[model samples]
Target: MRSGASRLDLLAARDARHALLVRHAGAGHPALVAVALNVPGEEKSPPGAEPLFRWALDQVIAALPGAWPLHVGDDALGPFALLASRAEAGGAKTACVAVEASHPAARLVDLDVYAPGGTVVDRAALGLPPRRCLLCEAAAGECIRLGRHPLDAVVARARALLADAPA
Candidate 1:
């Protein structure tokens, strides 16, 4: 895994239980950080995501049930603004935390439901693949056995356009 991915793992481990509040209404959406699927620096994302990155936040929102009130961009940072709008639309009040990860699109389903403050899980969160780098079975086996944490890699990235943009 890349250094960023490793960092993401650490964060996931730390915040696996904490739900970054995005769109809360009495009980807004809470999510975990998993950015293993996203690009580093988020060259594809808006300015903030390109540098800061909030992969899990976006992922969690996508995984949520009801349609959000605001529009979310395919790029990063849009999620935050969208979530804020959704919260108001839902008529619920809650604090939302912006999440970031090196692995883009990584998320934890029902994070707040599982652990409100935050929880520590095993290596499965690390996002180890089934194989060992296509050549190293040992490494792969270790990853499966140890299971790495998934949060350390990503930091929240917001878009400049959305930074000032309202929900």
Candidate 2:
């Protein structure tokens, strides 16, 4: 909650996401898709974010017709949805990745694919290159871990990306 402003909130959000995966995995879904916007700063649900999140969710649904929503709502961590799908984990990951790579705004949406065992299906598992940074060609995770960019700068870039995105 609180848009992960503190460490505890971030942990709580992570736990909540894991719980979603576990709950759906138990329901016999072969794969699960989790969607959430990558808005920077403590203000995850900033103005304009929810609508962009909705658009991204719609893209995911269109990509995976077999997927059905298990949960869809906004919280301290911003707009998010968890869906259980009959799609195979690998194929689902591929589709989600395609969505993520399709547009700049799409890149700001985290479309995670999960296996029935509650483990995320990473890009490496599908032989895809790691995601690139929003502002550069470096791996996104590496940029995040190294603090290669300022928070405000990332936020501004995100805003610009969202502005260019289809409403």
Clashing pairs in 2: none
State the TM-score for model 2. 0.91
TM-score of each: 0.23, 0.91
Tens-digit per-residue lDDT, 121-148, candidate 1: 2233444232222123454346435644
lDDT (CA) per prediction: 0.30, 0.84
RMSD of each: 12.4, 1.9
lDDT of 2 by residue, 78-136 (tens): 78899888888899999999898887788789998888777789999999899898889
- lDDT score for residue 158 of model 2: 86
